[model samples]
Target: MRLAIGLAAAAWAVIGSAASAQDYRPTFHPDQLKGPPAGAFNEVLVLGSPHLSDLPDSFRAEQLQPLLTRLEAWRPTAVAVENLSGLQCDFMRRYPSRYAESVEAFCYDPSAAGRALGMDVPTANAEVERLLEAWPKAPTAADRRRLAALFLAAGEPGSASVQWLRLPAAERVAGDSLTAEMAAALDRRMTRKNEVDLVAAVLAARLGHERLWAVDDHTADSATPPDEEEAQAKAIMAAWDNPYVQARKDADQRLYADLEHPDGVLNIYRDYNTPDTQMVVYRSDFGATHVEPSPQAFGRRYLGYWETRNLRMVANMRDVLGRYPGTRMLTIVGASHKGYYEAYLNQMHDVRLVSSDEVLR
Candidate 1:
């Protein structure tokens, strides 16, 4: 009887060990790993609007709703957004001024303004607020308080408003000043532009799925012009006197051109001025250039940091896919990033790219 009991116990230990090992392995299915259907793609939607006005009035009902519907239909298992470190979100809620400044920097940035205008609204904050409000259950008061604190520290008053109203006026004011200084410092960094896209992308992705992947680098650097390139680009522009170039230059001076209305012109100019940092234009050789320029660049640079970032992002995406095995992914990005990201991601095995027009249609 003792011998039989010992043998049974040893067998149970072996079975338990096997179960534990299997449990650690991710159990995603191979059949579920397919991309979007032919002629349809899993999307990484990109936008250029920096403010509310940038989105069309139909965006919610037209663009976003349809996309959400499709995503639900497709049933992706994971979503990602560019969010602050968990600690940062906590910090924002605890500190209002920092949160406000961060929010301000995000919403009031040149790109943010462009996004708003693209959506035909005054600010992107409206859309975000709308999203939060529409959701039956959102973050708790505690969460808001934490986010507000971060916004205050970040120097974004508008962002702070979402949570800081609960705080005393004196505290709010002090926080605002500090947040502003922090935001200014961040503005000087090159990461701000890319960070916005990364954040928005992550947010939208999170709303779509439980498992969220953040695929962006968070490093910050000052914007220093490449001296040789700057000189060369200046020389090139100085020498250009083509009629087309001259015509464009002339058109720029007029608030509205004869062919376009004032509102239309404003929209275009605003979008052009706040081009996405990751936007790329492909040359014949497949070499890339920044397709959009910051307001400071006067529309000269067409491609910027997007190429490097996209490569890394795509790799991260692939890693997620590998881990999940068959899970579908929806990417959100700046409009300028849409074209290139689509082109490249489509080349990956078993991956698809969806267009905004197609999704909205």
Candidate 2:
């Protein structure tokens, strides 16, 4: 085994040496440049979470209390989640052929309130900004309800949920241009148990934050041509059928099955954020896919798309931190994205990466 490992290392060294010989290789690193000497570093906590909607049926809202407590202790000044922005969805709506599916699956259509209030996504997005800028120190239920309606029209249910979750149950009903249908949708949204709703939005509301940022991006996802769809799926699935992936599945089943415990959700999160899980995820997913022997290079295509999506997501988070510099930001993303999020965000000059283990502990 040592002989095999030595041979692999030698081969990698040769490859690395050859790559180093290339004068075109970039010498500068972004992380090396940083900071206003006087200001606090922009701290970011990347929380890897399960898609709460996929949690076992036995799961309950109270199961999240401990996790919330830990995160609240961190006290993020800004919260971002893995959901596409309403404006992006609206832009994609113009080009259905490329983004129709992504829009349908991820974007909320706020046409009802949009029509009633004469606010399209762009218009409502602008209104949302205007309202928040002048948002009062102590906002009424009517204030929250109006903002919730604006969020809906902006195609941002995640942000809408921040407003929705803040309002008392009695104040959660329709009013202030939040039509009955949109109001009911917000009700359904708060109960959906998705990461954005149950976790990000809830935390944001508790922190007295007026809004949560939707930083997910699907701009790079293109529809696979009908003829090539099967080939792509076949190639990706072929890569996925590996031992590491199997082990991941087995562990997931055990974790989900154990959700009756008070700390079940936290345990699942710890499992996802563990250092060991990082290599497991890469080996099971991207690393495994990287070596697939597909004639169509479908695996690389899939990998490219994944990396691009994550990059854009990080860019969106950076955009938020740029707007509110030096503030701590909490980003709630999927388990698979934890490693990529850290790897990319670590390159930003002004950002300080916080350990998930530290926060989770």
Candidate 3:
């Protein structure tokens, strides 16, 4: 009788444990804690933007003025851009087999500027900080030119553009630390339609900021195995064929089509940041990958990369906020990264997520 009773009790315990496991929801929600009890709260605005380089030829650089005016009104104290730091790129340079293609493709080769200035990436990066630390109250055009050249040597053309734009039209010519070749290079950068140049750097310069922060990270990215390339591409593409992907594309097309409207471009940014956009986005991309049935589990591996990349990006953002509390940071990143950025950032105790709709308006 005793043996039979113990067995029945054990069966009930097993059943109860399984039931709880299936129904379990985490009770501790850090996102619910919206504020720090003391001191200034960190205000973060995550702006989702399409790759401006991909926009059609008809899109004018001046078209961004309206959007820029609105963001300027918000007066973000600092702006963080979606470009990898010179230091991170420098670190990745050591591992050629893993990062050769990524470095060649994504990272700017600052060697020429470095050679001209007699500064490697590290020394130039250090000089950038030292100069900024003792930055004068009223800097001359020469001061700006010197910093711009240092920024180029540091492999941060975006920040260099901020300094370039700050200069008077006449003072934009090569002199001081910025060599003639580098000046022409920056002239090219100033004309590029990409948001890093036309948007972030432009706005930062307009706001009187000396430099823009580079917070993008790519430590998670690696060279795809030659054999797995086809499998990986097929799995991700297959996942993207869902209705949500089509709907997202259609919605974006509708928004982009109306760029003639006063707020057409801004409206697209607002739409990308809505709360309802999260699951739709996930289903269209990462969630679909999660459900993909591949023997190689290529989908899961892709998902891991995506999550890890976003997590690291969020950490970089958080690190900035931690260093400088009470900052109104404008983080301009790619649209697909918006949902993940918000979800991860919300968990921080001091960070208060500002609605993009409010700022874009």
Candidate 4:
């Protein structure tokens, strides 16, 4: 709302006519946005988090408590996590062949896991609270598997896998409907993936939220032919070997190191929300300008697909906000997508972004 085209024309004159006549540059001064309209401001905090579980050996679940505690204080009306919708997970479970990859990734087995837990979706999420409350000091293998079944029942197979992984191989046997195949499904889901949203789920439950929103969209990234995909990746990587990119990589390493300390988690969140971090996302990652035209065009196509996915995810979040006006919502997503999500969500008439720095403090 702060954008003044008339003022922008006057400002353009300062750049000098030597700057290409065809070049388009519209400056964005976000401070100019008139604060949200009267009444309760609908606040949104788009949190960019690394996949914590994927971190090195030093990163433990307990280390996340302080970060979650800080977030819990924000008192979000709703929490949105990066995951497929429960309906989609159900369809994947029923028709595995059609959605084999997704079904495998989610480790959803409605017939077995669903029956074992005895609930679905909103009703099923209650088990999450029960598991948290009744978590044993030194849980037996049976206890672990039971929790795993409960997570699957709650439509959180990723978290279920984390629980199942804690059991010893010999003790990870079939129990009731939890057969070896089901156990393997759980194991497969945990493979090479982090349960980032599990943190979001815990925070939501602590705040008395009924359920978390599944706003991630996979339908936008269509399959490019394998050869074309490989070539595109090669070209993009070649362009990415610059000083700006290297500096970001160095900073990322430092951030990853900070995840080890309990207090460091808050610092990590604060750093991620800074304008410097968000600007790099555009200048180096999405807005890098030196690739040849052909490769650049190919890269642009990939960026388009990425933007489409974020747009759909935002639309899903908007759906939740529409149902409950004046709600404060928190979206927990991968750090790389943070800029895109904020950019699209800021365009919405009613939504206003809450400063993550203030929230961390």
Q: Write the per-residue lDDT of candidate 1 for residues 1-361, one digit (tens) a residue.
A: 9999999999999999999998886676543565554444433433322222343332221223323454455444555433332323333434544355443333333233223234322233344345445543445444444444343333232333424333333343323223444334432331223323323333333343212344432222113346556754554454342354444345434433321342442343234323232232222112322222234542233224445556655666666665555555655443344455555565566565444443333
- lDDT tens digits, residues 1-361, model 2? 9999999999999999888787465779887777653678889999988898888788898899989999999999999988888899999999999999988898877788789899778999999999888989989999999998888889888888899988988999998888889888888887887888888999999998888888999999899999999988999999999999988989999999888888999999989999898899999999978988899899898899999999999999999888887889999999899999999999999899999899888
TM-scores of all models? 0.37, 0.92, 0.92, 0.67
> What is the Cα-based lDDT of residue 117 in candidate 3?
92
Residue 357 lDDT, candidate 3, scale 0-100: 77
User: Cα-based RMSD of the predictions, in order?
Assistant: 18.7, 6.0, 3.0, 9.5
| Local distance difference test values of all predictions, in order | 0.40, 0.89, 0.89, 0.70
Residues 184-208, candidate 3: write the lDDT tens digits. 9999998998989988999998899
Q: Better model by lDDT, 2 or 4? A: 2
RMSD of 4: 9.5
Number of the candidate with higher lDDT, 3 or 4:
3
Shift in Å, residue 83, candidate 4: 1.0
Candidate 4's TM-score reads 0.67
Model 2 stretches astray by more than 4 angstroms: 1-25
